[model samples]
Target chain A: MKKRLFTPGPTPVPEEVMLRMAAPIIHHRNPEFMEILARVHENLRYLFQTTQPVVALSCSGTGGMEAAVSSLFGEGDKVITVNAGKFGERWTELVQLYTGSSTEETLPWGSAITPERLKQLLKEHPDAKGICLTHSETSTGTASDIKTLSAVIREHSEALVLVDGITAIGAHEFHFDDWGIDICITGSQKGLMMPPGLALVAISERAQERINEPARKPSNYYLSLKKALESHAGDDTPFTPAVSLVIGLDEALTMIRSEGIEHVWKRHESLAAACRAGCIALGMKIFSSSPSFAVTPVWLPEGADWTEFNDALKHDNGITVAAGQDAFKGKIFRISHLGYYDELDMLTVIGAIERAMKAIGLPLTPGTGVTAVQKAFLGK
Target chain B: MKKRLFTPGPTPVPEEVMLRMAAPIIHHRNPEFMEILARVHENLRYLFQTTQPVVALSCSGTGGMEAAVSSLFGEGDKVITVNAGKFGERWTELVQLYTGSSTEETLPWGSAITPERLKQLLKEHPDAKGICLTHSETSTGTASDIKTLSAVIREHSEALVLVDGITAIGAHEFHFDDWGIDICITGSQKGLMMPPGLALVAISERAQERINEPARKPSNYYLSLKKALESHAGDDTPFTPAVSLVIGLDEALTMIRSEGIEHVWKRHESLAAACRAGCIALGMKIFSSSPSFAVTPVWLPEGADWTEFNDALKHDNGITVAAGQDAFKGKIFRISHLGYYDELDMLTVIGAIERAMKAIGLPLTPGTGVTAVQKAFLGK
Candidate 1:
């Protein structure tokens, strides 16, 4: 069977990137690798739209999130977390771990946190050390208005704004400097179009000042932003980096650079639009109110079994999409338009989904979704 | 030029493993990946010589070391660290970060920690929370007697024995269960013959008890062993795993299983002996007093510039080895016999070193090191 990946992350890696990784591994300490790392940092800054050099760690995006939390705030510090989905809940969980006090400004899953609510939360927690939110919530396929939230933070609070841009950075509109984000964290498997391993963290000057504070002691060696940033300044990694992943990312980032980040975002937007149109045309409701360009979610049709539907989509049609996570499981399914994807890929996915839905005895015509996809793509 | 990677950690990966990783990316949440993770965990136990399922983290070996430290002990805890080389120094740094106080048992670079010294340290620090040491100090290519040291610790005090087996696990003899080790950590790039990304941590029942202590609130989130161990029990990962690396590691571990881990250690030992013989035949002194089977450190010939020597070896001969780290930089160069290495590979490396030496105008028989490598391998 020709297996296809449609998950938000671990997306289809460009063959070039995979081949780059497949080559012999390079030593982190090697000057050759140092040049590659330097290039990757520069390109990552462009992707994050920042002037500061990004700190790349040899861990997943969750590690990057923890690094931001553990490094920026001290124990018992007051923080605010936006909990709209699983990823947001993670931010809340991590914030609670370090900070003894945290205000979880949460909404129902698949719902967006509004600027007014964020402003209210900021006003409520006057002593907030930081505000952690997801730029694009991967679990619920929800995208938040980060620019507006950042503006509100600037207006109402002295809290540092940390954004989990894991699924958003290159896929959505992100301006680190313009929006005044203290830190933006991302992973390789999503917008970077590479396999999972490396976590790139872009930090603003404000974040660096906090990191350099005399009293700041990140309770970690590997995830220490102080150590990572210092080494990155010297174009070196603090520890043994995931060299193959880094090398592949260099090529992947080059692809992003070649397409331009704006184009990457535009492509994601187009794919998401087409995917959502197809879902609606098939009479399925969209899951998230604020649909993310990275991924789209749709509620299952009435009487549709998730296992049978998924088996047809995955086993029969060779397409693998994600099911709803946690409490929402078995109710909704997701399709990613994140990385290394195009209009054709979305059409293929929707076409496959249509077949799966039909196989599961859902009231659907074969060409209905596919024609909707073409119409949406052509309209865009 | 055909590039050769010989640094200790990011060693050469097997072609099969690289090919597996080069395949289309698989979602970490996929059942296929779960099966791969289970297989990896089981085989990691075989590699570590233990019955426990190893906790795999999406970070470097240093991350694994820190995870063990931050998870097992707490704030103001008194921990003991062995500082022999760079990696050992990392252990000291990490311990000092979490533990208010730490006793560093110091040894010169290229020297091993004696079992008697460990016993004495254990006696002195009878109130120590835990003791952290490197099974093989990667910087100076020195291997310690972990079995004897564990026995000493077993007889002495109640400190947990945590070993950084990054360079030593598959290359050197290890017995996680029989040696009474509490926690042993290794990475994929070492003797597992894969790229850098995954950190495999094998924990004993004794260590789990400490981790599960009701009062234990590890000052970490991403590096938390409690979550990792819990997830591993369900054949899952705590966070997004480095799926390609894990998939590649699954194949790499399968290779080790085919040959047997004992034979893996023996092969590394044989390669190290041949490398050491080649160094001696070239009339150069071996650097480490307790040279590891993973890597062999050799003192540069008198009046030879390190840069010129490395340039000739790396650029001219296309064989990339490592230079001495930290204070020993420029004083010596190191050759790795770590992973995916065999007799012919050793001969190729030694032959390149000989040619490189000749290019640098060293007085030597052309085939001296090569002949020695061949003789050593045949003798073994």
Candidate 2:
């Protein structure tokens, strides 16, 4: 079977990057390896659209989130966390775990937090130390307006703005310095088009000041952002890093740079638009009102079992799409058009979904979805 | 240039494992991925030589060491850490960071700690909560007698025995259950013949009890062993794991199982013996008196610059060997006989080293090292 990955993360890694990583591993401390790290550092800054130092740690995306919470704020420091999806809930959880005093501004899943609400929250919580936001919520396939939200926080509050750009940075246009974001975190498996195990965090000088505050004490030893920045300045890591993954990331980033970030974002946008058009033509409702360009979520048709639909797509068509998480499970299915995806790949996924839906006895016009996807790709 | 990796940790990944990892990425929560994890769990227990559950974390080997310390003990608890090399020093550092009180037993870089010394330390620190040992110190190519040391700790004290078997478990013979080791940690890149991302830690029932103790308050949020174990029960990880690395590891473990553990150890032993014989034939002294089968450290000749030798080997021959770390740097170079390495590979490395030595004006008979390696392989 020809298996295809259409998940939000662990997207299809480019063959060039895979082959680059498959080469013989190099010692991390060697000058050769350090040269690779130096290239990766420069490319990471370019990808993040920031002049600040971006450090890579050998852990998952959640590790980066934890590092932000542990390093920037001390005990009793109140943080305002937005909870709009599974990842947003993680921010709330991390803040509660690390700070013990955080205000969770909750919103229903699949809905974006408005800048006005953020302004109101900031007005209410004047002592808030930071505001955690999700640039693109992977679980719900919705992207919050980071630029607007960060602008609101910058205008209204002294709190540092932290954005989880796990699935957003490469797929969308994210200007860290322009938006005045203090911290931006991403994972290697998502927009970077590589395997997991690396959390790349871009920290601004404002965040560094908080980390270097003499009065602030952090409990974390491994994921210390201060130490990570210190070592990264020397093109090294505090510990033995995931050397092969970094090599893979360097290749992936180089590919992205060659393709141009704007082109990458435009490709994602077009692919996502085609997917949404296909879903609408099939008479299925898009799950998120403000869907992200990284992934497209659609509610299953009436009397459709999401489990059976996704399983048929996997077993019969050799396609793997993600089922909705938490309360949304069994009700929605998501198709990712993030990395290494094109209009042709999107058409293939839509064809598979159409076949699976018909196999599940869902009423759908034959060739409707594929035709719509082709029309969208043709800009009809 | 045809490159070769002969470092200890980032040892050569087998071609099959590399190709497997190079395949399209899969979602971590997908059924296909869970199936891979289930198979990895069974094979990890086999490789660790234990019936206990082995959980995989998406971090380096050092993360596993930190988890063992943070999860099992609280502040002010005393741990006896052995510092014989760079990795052993990490244990002392972690213990002091997590637990305020710890006894560090320092030894010469290449020398192994004796059972009598451990017994005396245990007697002196009667309230010690744990004993940390390095099964194979990669920096010096020294393999400590873990079985004898664990037995001594078991007989003389109630401290939990923790072994950093990063370069030991698959390359050498280690019986976790038989040796009564409480916690054993290994990395993906060393004996596992994979890239550096995943950390495999085998935990015993004793350690689980200590983790579950109500009085235990772990400060770490990401690398929590107790939470990791809970998720592993369902064949999952607490965070997004290194999915491609896990796939690579699955293939590597399958290869190990097919070869049989005993045969694997024998191969490493023979390869290391061949390397040692080759070095001796070239009039070079082995650096570690208690050298590990995973790697062979050789002292550079008097007045010879190790940097120039290694650089020539890398540039001219496309071979990558490790220079000694810290105090041993420039004094010695290491040749790894670990995973994905055989007698032929050892001969090739020895030939390259001889050529580089001759290029550096060192006196050596032509083909002396290669002939010695061939003779050692023939048991002559």
Best by TM-score: 1
lDDT of 1 by residue, A95-152 (tens): 8888766788878999988889888888788988889989999999999999999999
Compose the digit string of candidate 2's lDDT tens values, residues B103-126.
999999889999888888988999
Instruction: Highest DockQ: give the candidate number.
Output: 1
- Least well predicted 10-residue stretch by lDDT in candidate 1 chain B: B371-380
lDDT of 2 at B287: 89
Candidate 1, superposed: residue stretches over 4 Å from native: none
Q: lDDT per prediction?
A: 0.89, 0.90
C-alpha lDDT of residue B380 in model 2 = 72
Q: Every prediction's TM-score for the first chain? A: 0.98, 0.99
Flag regions of model 2 displaced more than 4 Å.
A214-218
Worst 10 residues of 1 chain A by lDDT: A215-224
- The most accurate candidate by lDDT is 2
